[model samples]
Target: MDDKSLVLPGAIFALFSIAMIWPPDEFVSAGATFEHLFYRWIGDFSLNIVEYQLRKILVNRVCVACLPALFSLYIILNVPPTALSTFVATAGLASMIMGLAYAFYTISTNFSQTRQVKELALYGGDVHRLMTEITQEYLEFANFAVSFAHSSREVVGSHWLIHITRFDFTIVNLTDVVFEVVRSATVDLNIERPNDQLQFLIIEAKIPHKNIKSFRFRVRTDQFRDLQDRVAAPIGMARNVILHQSLNERFVKAFVSCIDKNPRAVYSRLGELEPCFGCSSEIPNVKIEKRCTSIIEGARECRQCFCRPMWCVGCLGRIFAAKQEQERPDIWLDGQATCPTCRAEFCMLDVAFVVAEESQLDGNF
Candidate 1:
């Protein structure tokens, strides 16, 4: 092939290398990009240490071999047997030889070591079974959940089972969690205000080997409360894990506090209360009544919502959150959002938690 034709292939190879090494969020969301590219040689599963290591080694060797070969091919094709071309060709050839020798040495030394001997022996038993079972709960771009027979927990990243455990047959237990550290820093430093919306909940616990292991979960900024009603196994084992100082939990608490401070309304009859329009399961217990002093022109100010109690506290909190500037969560508490039913502008102070008073019917009737 001509030297000009090599430009496209070289660019493609560079991108492929980047994706393999430090994959972008997009590539990870695509699912098994690295494995799919080298499926023939690397195989599909990297569940265990042996498979993972072998795939790594194979990919490294291929890259090492291909890089020098491309360099040599370019020089050979472009330059016609000149002294410079000969020297370049020789250098490329020698480079490939050195790379091959290094690959051979690495492979030979790795195979001789018995570090993974125990792991290899236990792969077919409980190790493989745990990974296989956890794999079913794996969701790309979503929270990684590894559910065990006794407990279910959310992992930091997608490859936690393969990377962290390395198929050691260790059952991850966070039952004795002493404390959870919540981390929240501005994702974009250029922004003046520190965005509390972007946060991570970290839980540190001792794994099988008594080694301190930390599992981090990315907090969902959009949702005030974590959705526990998933199709996967119940993760109630770590239910209280995010309750301590989590930004999401803090948002919910702040919203509820605001609702409590607002003017409370009581219904004479319990029959007037209806199910929340957002989530049909819960009864609407909150009414939007303009209690804020802010009076701005247009639909920017807090206005009374003539609509009935059509939203529960949880649903109203979520709606309030959705209207605020996601990038600037600092102004979320003071932001105004339109009511879902009447489109009347309302702020956090306008939402009131309603209590229904039941009236007893006299027997004399």
Candidate 2:
């Protein structure tokens, strides 16, 4: 075959390498496809075991690195010995060597059976206990990270903290560790509202013999309170760090609490209510009606929203919060916000539950 024939195999190999490292949504979402292709041999191995997961990761990497090399070698053997074939052979050999070296390094650092000294360095005095904790029952691996009840394998543990990446796994003691929450600069405008951005919890630990010093873990604003209750160590009072609630999130809670006290708006049971426009996962259970005494009290009159009930309470709360002055959060509830579907203005007092059937209110509503 001509040198031009190499194009197909080369392109295929390149795509394979990319997919192995950064798999597309189909590979991730389709569990059967992902398991059959990647973990076909090791599918039966218990994910709870740290050793099994480490071995799985190491095997995956080796495969990722060596598969391309094997493809290159196949091309060299099939095609005539040209300069292109010679170059392919050289690249194949290099790839094999790199993969083997990485495998060896991983075995030495992560595997206790291979290198006892590294294990001692990792666990120190609690070697036996910590080793047992890690190996016995870890949660299912989520992208090389495990999730326990309070902490994750990639973040905090009861006594230890671990950071697992594609290439490295670093673990450190929780002793003398400092935690700080900071605002994340990277914002997904499509996913998050303009005012409510993301935040991350930084875990800085003192590792004696490790190059890694800190790990950044994502913490959702709504789950912060629960996290605080679960975490043993108090968050550090450091400069430029905040563990307080995001304005939008705080407003959501308050909005829900206030609107819950208001009377329910009766909708016709004949009409089928659709899923929320803001978050499609939930049913539209809220309506914007002028039930508040603001109009009688001589405040800004709240117009009755003629739009259909198309928003959940949580989503409506979010929209209401997002429309308010971001800087003036104190006056947020007292202020008015225009309905997302209709331009009619309404306050938190006007938000009400949509009850189609009075009987369903006790159970599903």
Candidate 3:
């Protein structure tokens, strides 16, 4: 549906049209008469065909040898065994050679876009599945904890309720036993979980005996802010939670490292920083000059994680576009965006461009 999708098909149609309307006499009388005038035009036209075929072969290497062989056979069958046949055969052979050469180049290009689509589907599915599982697990855990809290109140002679809050998943409690349970859950969820599904639960609870009436505990995730929006309860109650932690450190790291390692991190103690986490050559402070202005100019970050570099607008746009295409087959909502690093939901409009200001440049220097 996009302009890029139409490119190859449109080119094929134009080539087919040209070939259909091509006069047979033009081929036969190519060098027979008006050698000076027709010769250059014929040569140019033949070169154009060769170039076009070569380009096509670059896109699909499978067609390289096959197309040339088929065309060679056609030429051999059509042309009589005569002096003129030699010239036509030579032209056909030349086209075939060019096709073969370009075919070798196809390996480097993304000739099969289907591979990218498949990868996107798998990546999106895996993230979604992980998020669903984590949420379910958290819900179950919260229910158990709440029940334990109520039962403990009867034994302790003090009323205690877990009041879960935002960000850190902090849990407030009157008893040391409950505090330990909550702390263990937070650590396990944040640090011990799979690198790809790293997340923390935000919980709040009341300390019945103390002046400090409430306490909070947070299980940290890679994109805590993003998860906060997706997983939080409607009434800010822990039991009424909905966990949706789609983005994780591993996914973001893979995506960022897919193209290149962060140059800054490569030399620094950071080793290899994730570009999806807002580390890249394009960041103005990095002092690295990139040739692609679109990438450099379009850099943006999640507002929730202000200092951390998130993604170039172009890259994020493609990701958002791909997700939209995958989810809503009929309609695309361009404005919607979710940070893979912090799991924050935001509109495309909220993405701020990285502009190199005079003061900032001076500060960097």
Whose TM-score is greatest here? 2
Tell me model 2's lDDT, rounded to 2 decimals.
0.64
The sequence of per-residue lDDT tens digits that candidate 2 reaches over residues 126-153 is: 6656556654433423112333232234
Task: Give model 3's TM-score versus the native structure.
Answer: 0.19
Better of 2 and 3 by TM-score: 2
Task: Please identify model 3 stretches exceeding 4 Å from their true place.
Answer: 1-209, 214-245, 259-365
Predicted candidate 1 versus true structure: per-residue lDDT over 1-365, tens digit per residue: 33455466557756765554555567656763444466676654434434444555555554555565666776677656766556757877887877777657756775433233333333345644544544443433453344332113344223233223211222232232232234433244344654343533443333334343444433332321333332122333344443434344566678997677665665555476666777665788888887888565544766677777888787788778888777777778877889988898887778877665423221110
Q: What is the lDDT of residue 121 in candidate 2?
A: 53
Stretches of model 2 off by over 4 angstroms after superposition: 1-9, 31-48, 97-110, 113-122, 125-128, 135-155, 180-183, 191-193, 196-216, 220-229, 234-248, 256-365
lDDT of each: 0.54, 0.64, 0.36
User: What is the per-residue lDDT of model 3 for residues 39-89, given as tens digits with 9 covering 90 to 100?
Assistant: 332243223322222232233333323344454454466545555445545
The residue pairs in collision within model 1 are none
Relative to the true structure, candidate 3 has a C-alpha RMSD (angstroms) of 29.0
Model 1 / residue 53 / CA error / Å = 12
- How big is the positional error of residue 338 in model 2, measured in Å on the Cα after superposition? 25
> Which run of 10 residues does model 2 get worst, by summed lDDT?
142-151
Assess every candidate by TM-score.
0.45, 0.53, 0.19
